[model samples]
Target: MAAASIMPPHTNPPPPATARDPTATVSDPQRHRDAPTPSLRALFLRAVDPSRPSSWSTAVADLLSSGDPVAALAAFAAALRANPAALRPALPPALRAAAAATSLSAGRQLHLLALRSGLFPSDAYSASALLHMYYHCSRPLDARRAFDEIPAPNPVIVTAMASGCVRNNLVYTALSIFRSMVASDSAGVVDEAAALVALSASARVPDRGITGGIHALVSKIGLDGHTGLANTMLDAYAKGGGHDLGAARKLFDMMERDVVSWNTMIALYAQNGLSTEALGLYSKMLIVGGGVRCNAVTLSAVLLACAHAGAIQAGKRIHNQVVRMGLEDNVYVGTSVVDMYSKCGKVEMAWKAFQKIKGKNILSWSAMIAGYGMHGYGQEALHVFTDMRKSGLKPNYITFISVLAACSHAGLLNEGRYWYNTMKTEFGIEPGVEHYGCMVDLLGHAGCLDEAYDLIKEMKAKPDAALWGALLSACRIYKNVELAKISAERLFELDATNSGYYVLLSNIYAEAGRWKDVERTRVLVKTRGIEKPPGYSSVELKGKIHLFYVGDKSHPQYKEIYAYLEKLLERIQEAGYVPNTGSVLHDLDVEERESMLRIHSEKLAVAFALMNSVQGSVIHVIKNLRVCTDCHAAIKIITKLTGREIIVRDIKRFHHFKDGLCSCGDYW
Candidate 1:
C-alpha cells in the first residue's frame, strides 16, 4: 500500500535559522541562508546518477512499493535515462508490478523500454508479463503481437499466452496455439495448466470434438487424476450441448467429489431438464457426510431443479437452507430462488425473494419481472420494469424479452407494441427471435392474425418454428382454418419430426367440421411416423413428485384418488358445470368424449393432490402441454367448489384458479 516514490533523506535540506541579536547586531553580523530544496524529479535524477553511486534498483523498488504503477514506471524511466545498463536488469520486475496493478498504459511504456533495451521477447519472463498486461487491458491483438515476438518459447511462456487468449475470449486462437504445442514433442509435454486452459476454451466454444480430443490427451498424459483438471473436463462435456451426459457422468463418477464437482453435475442435470435426477443427486450430496458442503452454487442449481420439476416443497426447503446458510443475499442464489418460486407457480414467494436481494443487478431485476410475466401479472411486470429503469439499471435484451412476454400474456397489445418499438429506438437492442415471437404471440392472442403473418414476413431474421407455432395457436383460437393450415405447413417443414403441429392442424380442422381434412392430417402424421408424446402432469408433495398421465392408474393410492375424483365430478355437475366434449377433437360420441375429458392428465394430478395434500394448501400441477379449454374451465369450477387455490403451470404461462376465476382472466 506504499506510494511509488519516497524522497531521499537530505535531498531537500531545511532552511537555516538566523540568530537574533540586540540593537547593535545589524552592524555586527550577517546570517547565511540554506539553498532551496530540490524538486522530486531532481532528487530522483540524483538517485540514478552513476557518479553518485546510487542504487537505481532501490529507487525503482521504493517507487513500486508506493503501489502506483504509473509513478513506478516514471522512476524506472528516469533510472533508465541516467544509467541504462544498471536499470535494464530491473525492467522485468517493474513490468510485472505494472501488470499486477492492471495499469495497461504504464505497462505498455515499460514494454517499450524493454524493447528498446533488447530485453523483451528474448526475455521469456518479460514477454509473458507483457502478454498478461495486454490481456488485462482487453487488447488481445497486442497480446498476440507480444506472443509472436517470442523466439522458441518455453512451455511456461506458451501456457501463459494460451491462458491469456482464453481469458480474452480468443478461444479459437488459444486452441490453435494449444494444438501446435501438443504437436511439438520438443516443446515438452502439454502440462496440466495448458490442458485445463484448452478444455475451458473448448467448452466456451462448445466444440465437443475438441473437448473429446482434450479429454483423450489428458488421459494419455495421466493428468486426468488431477482433481481440478477432471472437474474442468466434466464441465466441458456437460456444457458442450452434446447428448453425452454419459461421458460427463462417467468423468464425474471417477473424480474425487468436490463442492464444485457436485455443483457442476447438479447444474448440468437441471439445465438438461433432468430435474428429478438433479434433486436426487442433491439429496445424495446432503446424506453423504464429508468436506463437500453445499454453497451458493449448489443451492442455486438445486433450486432450479425444483422449479423445473414443480417440486414446491423441496424448493421451500432449499430456500430455508439458503436463509440458514446466509446465502440468500448472494445475487446468483437470490435470482435462482426468485426464478424457482416463479416457475413453480409461487409468484408471491418469488416477489418476496426478489425484495430481499441486496444490490440487485439487471439479472435479478429481469428475473423478478419475468416471474411476474410468467404468472400473468403483466401490469406488475411492467411496473417492475419501470422501477428497474428508475433505479438506473438499463434494460438489456433479456429484460425487454421478459417485459414483452408479460404484455403478451396479459393481452397488453398497445404496451407490447410500444415497448417493442422503444426497445430498438431508445434502448438500441435489435429485436431477436424471442422478442419477435413474443410480439407475434401478443398479436395472435389479440386476433390480429394477418398482422402477425405480415410481421413474420417482415422479420429481419428468418422466422423459426416457434413463431409459426404461435401463429397456428392463434389461428386455432380464432377458428381460422385457412391460416392455421398455412402456419402448420411452415412449422412442419422446419420441424417435421414433431407430431404436435400435425395434431394442432387436425384440431383446427375438426373445430371447423372438416372431417376429411382431419383424416388426411392423421394419415400424414402416420405416414411420417411421428408419434405425439403423451401428456403428463406432476404434483410434488412431501418432497416427492407424483406424475399422472391421461387415464393413468399406476399410483399406489389410485383407487382412493379415482373415487374422490368421481365424487368431486358429481358435485361439480350438481354445481351446474357441464363437460365441454369439444376439447376431445375426436369422432367419438359425446358421452365417450366427455369420459376422455374426465381423465385428462391435469385433472388426475389435481385429484391426487387433493387426496394427499393437507386441506387449505395450494395445489400446484405442472403439465407437459397447454391446458385444454375444457380443463381450464373445469379447474375454475373445481377451485370454486373446493374453496382452495389451484395453480397449474403448463408449457406456456401459469393459471391460478380461485373462486371460478383465473389469473389469466380466461384469455390464456
Candidate 2:
C-alpha cells in the first residue's frame, strides 16, 4: 500500500517506497538486499544533505546522469520531505528528472508541490522546466496551461514554450509564439537560439511564406550569416513545401559554408532529384569550402547523390573516404554505401557494404530490400526481409513498401498480394499511398486490370491521383484503352494540374488509333496552360555533368557527339534495328518521326559517353522520364553491336543492357 500510494495515482514502481525514516531514500527491497553497503544514502551523503535541498537536487541530477536514476529520484524525494520551503529550488531539477523518466504523474505532483508552496507561477525557472517536462511526457496542453500561468515570461520561458510546442506537433502554436516574439522583441528574445526554433517549426508546416518571412526577420537581425542559424534555414527551405533550390543555392553561395551548410545544400539537391547538382556541390564543399571536414551526414548525403546520379565513380571515391575515416562500419555511412551501390546497378558492392555494418537498423534493411527490388531481384529481397524479421526487428511501413515493390518489379504477383495482406492483417501496418501504388503497379503489370480497379474501389482509404496514375502507366504498356480512360478520368478529378497524366492518356490514345482524342488532350494542355517538365538525360564525366535534351546542341562537343550518334544509328540500322516512330506522338510523316527519334535525349547522352569513355567501360545514363519502347530496342541493339554495357536508370528502375539482353527481362 505504501509503495502504491507513493505515487499520486498512476506511476510505475512507486517512488522508492516512502521509507519509515522519511529520509530513507531507498526502496525496502533494495534496503533488505543491500543494506549497510553503499546504499543510495551513502552515495547521497558524499555530495548532499536532505535538509540542504540544492545540493540534494544536485546529487539527484548527478545520479540520473550517471545511470542511477532510481537513486537520484530517491534523493529528490528525501530533499522534498526535509524542507517544503526548498521546493522552489528543487522544482526545476525534479521536473527535469520527471521528464527524463517520462513520468507524467511525478511531474504533475511536482507541479502541485510547487503550487502548494505558493512558489510557482512567478518562478520562471520552474515554469520553463514544467513546460519541458510536460512535453517530454506528451502532455502539450498541460504545458500550455502551465505557460499561461506565468505572469511575466522571459526569453528562456518563451524559447522553451516555442520548442515544446514544435516538438509536440503543435507547430502552428509554435509559429504563433514565434510571431509574437518577433512582433514584440522588447526583451530581444528573437536571438539565434529562438530563431532556430522558429525555423524548425516552419520546416514542419511546409509553408514557404512563413519560412521566407522568418528568413527575412533573421537577416534583419544580422543573424543570417551565423553558420548554425543558416543551416536551420537551409533545412527549412529544403523541407518547407516547394523546394526553391535556386534560392537555397544562392543562400549557400553567399554564406561562409561550413560542413553543415554544405551537407544541407547537398541534401536539398538530392531531395529535389537534382543528383548531378548534389554531386557537384559535394566536390566544391571539399575543395573550396575552406577545409570543412566531412562528417557522417556529409558523406551519407553525397553518397545518396551518387546513387541517384549513377556516378559510381563518385560513389567509390566517397566510399574510399568512408574507409579512410574509419567509418566503414557506421550504420549511417554503411547504409548509404549500400544504397548507393544498390541503385547504381552494383548489387554485389551493396551486399558487401551491407554485410560490414555492425548493427543494422530498419533503414539499413529497407535500403537493401529496395535495392534488390530496383534490380528486379524479388526472391533475394524476400530472403533479406526474412532475415530482418529473424534479427528481432519488426518490419515498418517502409519495409513493407520495399517488399511489395520488389515483388512487383519481379512479377511475383502472389507474393505481392500475400505480403500486402500480411502487412495489414498480421503486422497491422496499414498500406499507405506508396504501398497501394506498388500494388496497383504490380496488378497492372500482370494485366490484372479489373482486379487492380476492384482493389482501388475497395480500399478503406481513398486513392490519390498517383495511385490511379500508376494504373494508367500500366495501361500504356498493355494498351488497355478503356481502363486507361477510366484511370485518366480519376486522375483529372484528383490532380488535374499534372501534365504527365494528360501526356500519358494522349500516348495511350495515339497507340490505339484514337488520333482525335490525342489531339483534344494535346489542345487541353495549351488551353489550361499546363507546363510539362522537359525530358533530359544527364551523364557524369570527369567530375562534371553533361545534360542532353532532345536534339540538345548546347554542349561544346555537340558536333562530335552528333557525328558519333549518326554512325551508331547507321550501324544499328544495318544490324536489323528499326525505329519505332509511333513513340513520337506527333502527327508527322514517318520520315520526320524516325528523324526525331534518332536524336532522343538518352541516345545523345549514350553517344557522348561512348565517344568519351574508354572502350567497353559501362556507360551510365540517367533519364528524367521512362525509356520509350524505341530507345529500349535501340539500346539493346547498340549494346550487342558495340559490346559495351549501357546502364540506363529511368524513373521506374534500372535497365542494364548487355549482349542485347536487359536485366529487367524487357518487362520495363
Candidate 3:
C-alpha cells in the first residue's frame, strides 16, 4: 500500500482494468473521488521555490490573476513567508486586485501584511487600496481603521472614506470626516469631488445648518458653476423635508438649465401643491427649446401636476406624448399616467393604462386601485386587489389604505372590517393612523358611530385632526348635533385656525336649531381672524383652464354663463328638483337661500361646461372644497335633464352624476 503505487503519476491516468478489478485489491473509487483537494497554501508552496526569488513574484502574479482573491491571498502569504523583499513590491497590486474583486477576507490579510512590513502608514497607495477594499465590501469600520492609519491622507483617500461613511448611513460620521479634512491642511485643499460627497452626506442628515454651510463653502470655493453640485444642492432644499421651495427655486433659476434642472423644479412645484405653476414652468421649458428633451422624469412630474390640477385634456396630451416617446412601459411614468387619469375622473383610462404597463410593480397596482376607489368603483377596486394577489404581488400598507378607502366610499362595511383585520392578522401590517381613519369613516358613514368611537378609543396611535374631522363630517351628514359638537371641540384644539371647522360647527348648530350657538361660533371665527377660503371650481376645456369662484362674474363670458345657468336651473326645477335651502347655513329667507345656491362654484362651472363643450361629452370639474348638498343634488338632476355625464372631483373624492343618480348613491 505505498502511496506512489496507489496514486498515478501527474502525466498518467489510472488504468481502466485496475478500476474494474476487485480481486486486484482496487482502491475504493468513491473514497478516491471524495479525497480532499490541496489547500491554497499547499498549492502556493508547490508553485514557488524559496531559493528562486523570481519564482516568488511569478507565483504571486499567477495566483492573483486566477480571478479568485481568496486563493491569491494564500499565495501572497506563502510568497511573503518565502521572500518578504520580493513580495513587498507585489503586495500593493495584490491589494488592488482584491479590492477590484471585492474580497474582504483577502483584503484583510493583505492589509495585515502591509502593516507588519511597515508599508502601510508610509505607503499612501497601499493604504488607499486597502481602504477602497473595505469600502466596496461595505465594512465602514475597517475602511475607517485603514483611513486613520494613513499618516498623511490625501484628498482622494478622504473622499473615499467620507463616501463609504455616507453609503453605510453614517452621514454624521461622514460630515465629521469632511470637516476634519477641511480643518487640517494635510490634504492641502478639498476639491469639488470631496465637496460633492459632503453635500450628499449633509442632504441625508438634512441638517439645515450643515446644508447652508456647505452651500456657502461651495460658493466660496467657486464650485457653484459645477452643474451636478448645484443640482444636488437644489434637491437638498426641495426634498430635505424642510421644503424651502423659495430657496430651491432661486437656486434653480441661477443655474444654466439642463433637463435635470427642469425636472427638479417641476417636481418641487408638483409636490408642494403648486400644480398651476408647475404646468406653467413645464410649458416654459418646452418653449425655451434649448434642446432639452423631456425624459421619463419630466413626463412623470408634469403628469402629476395635471392630475392635481384636474387638467384632463392636458393629461391626455401628455399621455399621447408618453406613448410617442415609448415611455408608457416605464413603471414610474405609467403609474403617474394612471394617477392623473384617475384623479381627473377618468378611471376607465386609468385601468387601460394600468393594463398597458409591461411589468406592473406595487405602485402601478396601487395607483389603479386608488383610482377606482376615488371614483366610487369599490367593487372594481376589490377585483383589482384580488388580481394583484393572484399575480403573487404582496400588497403594502399604502395598497390597503386605498382598498379600505374604497370600501368606505362604497359603504362596504363588512369588507372594510374584514380587510382591517386581515391587514394585522394575515399581512402583519400594523394599521397606521390613516388606516384607522378610513375605518372610522367607514363606520360613521354606515351610521355605526358608537362602533367608530370604540375603535378610535382602542387605537394604538393618537388620532390626528383629520381623523376627528372625518367623524365630525359624518355627524354633519347624519345630523348628530351632540357628537358633532364633541368632534368639533377636539378638532378646534388640534387646528384652531382652520375656518372650515368653524363653518362646519356653525352648520351643525343651525341643523340642530341652536341659533345662539351658531352666532357664537360665527363670532369665534371672526375673533380668531379665520377667514374661510373661497371655494373655486375649475374645468379644463380646449386645453385652457376656466376657474369659477362663488358668484364669480369676472370672466368676459360671465353674462352668457349666468344666463345659461338661469335657464338650466329652470329646466332642473321643472324636473321636480327642490333646492336644499338647509345647505345655505344662513339666516336668509327662502328666496335668498335659493339665489345663493344657484350661483355656487360647481353650478357655475357646470353651466360653463354645458355651454362650451359639445353635447354628450363627459364634463370633468375639480372643486377646491367639498361639494355642497344643494349643488350635489342639483348636479344629479342636471345630468339627467341634459343627458350628459358629469364627473366632479372635490377635495374628498370623485362624484359621478348620470341619469338622476350619483355613483355614491346619495351617501356621499
Which residue pairs in candidate 2 have backbone atoms (N, alpha carbon, C) closer than 3 angstroms, thus clashing?
none
Candidate 3: regions farther than 4 A off = 1-188, 197-219, 237-254, 580-599
TM-score of each: 0.80, 0.87, 0.75
Number of the predicted model whose lDDT against the real structure is largest: 2
Candidate scoring better on lDDT of 1 and 3? 1
* Model 1 lowest lDDT segment of ten: 31-40
Q: Which of the two candidates, 1 or 3, achieves a greater TM-score against the reference?
A: 1
Off by over 4 Å in 1: 1-114, 129-149, 164-180, 186-188, 202-220, 559-598
Rank list by TM-score: 2, 1, 3
lDDT of 3 by residue, 1-668 (tens): 01111111122321122223222211223322222122243344444356455665555455445444444444455555555565555666667556656766667766766777788878876776677778877888888777777777877877878887888888888899889877876433678888888878877875566767888988876778888888888777766646677887898878877899899889989988788888888888988838998899999999999999899988999999999999888999999999999999988999999988988999899999989998888899999999999999999999999999999988899999999999999999999999998998999999988788788878998888888888888898889888888888888888887777777778888878998888888777767777557789999889888899888878789999998988888889999889765642543222224444447899999999999999879999999999988899999999999899999999879999999899888876
In candidate 1, what are the lDDT values of residues 143-225, reduced to their tens digit?
Answer: 87887778787888888888888888888989998998888965345989899889888888855577888999888877777
Candidate 2, residue 662: lDDT: 91
Model 1 residue 357 distance off true place after TM-score fit, in angstroms: 1.6
- What do the candidate models score in CA lDDT, each in turn? 0.80, 0.81, 0.79
Candidate 2: worst-modelled 10 consecutive residues by lDDT: 1-10
